[model samples]
Target chain A: LAKTTQPISMDSYEGQEVNITCSHNNIATNDYITWYQQFPSQGPRFIIQGYKTKVTNEVASLFIPADRKSSTLSLPRVSLSDTAVYYCLVGDGTHNTNAGKSTFGDGTTLTVKP
Target chain B: EAGVAQSPRYKIIEKRQSVAFWCNPISGHATLYWYQQILGQGPKLLIQFQNNGVVDDSQLPKDRFSAERLKGVDSTLKIQPAKLEDSAVYLCASSLDSRLAGRTGELFFGEGSRLTVL
Candidate 1:
């Protein structure tokens, strides 16, 4: 599995844009970058996923550089409720398969304050 | 659709005692997993199952921990003679298909089962 590097924590004010970047230099060719947000006492929820370039959805946007060595998760107009730990995982997302799977890192905890 | 389900939200047991945790994945998901999360750390995969077959269990401590997903549906994780270090949240997650060997979406996780070994 490819290892990932990201910030341990980040602080943001309401209405501001927040971007969390993760570096996975050894990422596999078939690996996809995915981000999940986890609130206190709850399981992580999928936010967005991308193989390359950029992908956006109702909740967030993902930017993958040309090298695929790193990626960023962008959240717009953040609110206090957005406070949670965000995990950046790189994998093919094939559940039963083996080799170069997803490894969960200590996520970047974002604190969205009032 | 129903989400993954886990039970006995919390557990407290004495050292050397045994305990078990249960999980029910979303309908139609063929893959299931068990992870251990110590406070302040990201979850670590303890085992993985493709239906009723074991996919990977390299991280599980064989002497103490065991898990089974019978009939490829609900699953159970058990630890015999729990230790102090076993005091962590046991998490259950389900995914639609296999990754490298199989084929889909990110895993859906259930609220974890917190365990405290006294």
Candidate 2:
């Protein structure tokens, strides 16, 4: 499992773009970067995942540099309801045998202000 | 489709007592997981089950905590002689499959069972 580091908290205003970065210096070759968002009293929801370069989805986008040492999650036009905790995890998603046991860090708390 | 279902949304018990939580995964799902979430922290995986079989339980406190997923559908987690630190939300999650492309590890989780040890 690759250890990940992220900001403890971030503040942003509505309609502004928000970006959260995660560092995983020890990421493995087969590891994939995954981001999850968790609202208050709810389970974490998958937002985006990528192996390298950039991957975009309707909800968010993930950018992974060639070095793979770090990655960033970009949220466009943030809203008050976007307030939640975001977690970045790096693991071998190719191996389903033990994927469910992946570790989750404390996560970054995003506060979307009105 | 109905998401994962859990029971007894809240539970209160005294130290040294026993408590149990139940979960029902989405139909046809093959992987189930039990996680513990302490306030202000991310959820910790306690156990994982793959169709009535245990996959990973390295983090589970076997001496006091035990879980079972019989018939590959519903599961139960039990704690004996609970302690103060055991007070947390117990989360149950399930995925259609564990394979990489099968579901990309996307998990559907229940509302969770909040336990308070007094």
Candidate 3:
């Protein structure tokens, strides 16, 4: 599993776009970047995933560079409901479905102010 | 569709006592995971099950923690001789069989069982 580093906390206002970047210097060739959002008292939920370049979903957008060394999760028009911790995971199922066993760091706590 | 279900959403016990949590994954899901989330930290994976078999449990504290997925659909995680540091939320998550999907699948999590070891 590739290790990821992200900010401890970030703040933004409602209706603004919030971008959280994660650094993974030792990413693997088969690794795919995935983002998950966790609310208070709730489990983390999938936000978006990308192998390279960019991938957008109804909830968020994931931008990955060609090197795949890092990835950014962009939440457009954020709301107070979006205040939660976000996790960046880099792995795939190539090695015995280990992706399902990927490690999670102390995620970046995003606070969306009204 | 019903999501993953966990029982005894909360448990409290003194140190050295035992506690157990039960979970039922979504129907047809083949992969199950148990994670421990301490306050102010990310959830750490303790074990993963592929159907009725164990796939990974290197992170589990074998001396104290144990988990089983008997029918490959529901699971139970037990902790004996609990310590104060074991106070945290025990989360159960499930996903489709990635081997059949040919790609990593998203995890569906339950509400979680919060354990408070005094």
Second chain alone, TM-score for each candidate: 0.95, 0.96, 0.96
Model 3: lDDT equals 0.87
Q: Model 1 chain B: which ten-residue window has the lowest total lDDT?
A: B97-106
Compare the candidates by TM-score and give the number of the best one.
1
**lDDT by candidate, in order shown:** 0.88, 0.86, 0.87
Better of 1 and 3 by TM-score: 1
Q: Provide the lDDT at B94 for model 3.
A: 91
DockQ of 3: 0.58
Clash pairs detected, candidate 3: none
- Predictions' DockQ, in order: 0.65, 0.50, 0.58
List, residue by residue over A2-99, the lDDT tens digit for candidate 1: 78899999999999999999999888776778898888888888888898999999999999999999999999999999999999888754332133
Which interface RMSD values do the candidates have, in the order shown? 2.2, 3.0, 2.7
- Residue B54 C-alpha lDDT in model 1: 93
**lDDT by residue for model 2 (B1-118), tens:** 9989998899999999999999999999888999999999988889989899998899999999999998999999999989999999999999866754424556778889999999
- Which predicted model would earn the best lDDT? 1
Best prediction by DockQ: 1
Clashes of 2: 0
Q: Which stretches in model 1 have alpha-carbon errors above 4 Å?
A: A94-99, B99-103
- CAPRI-wise, candidate 2 is medium
Show where candidate 3 strays beyond 4 Å.
A93-101
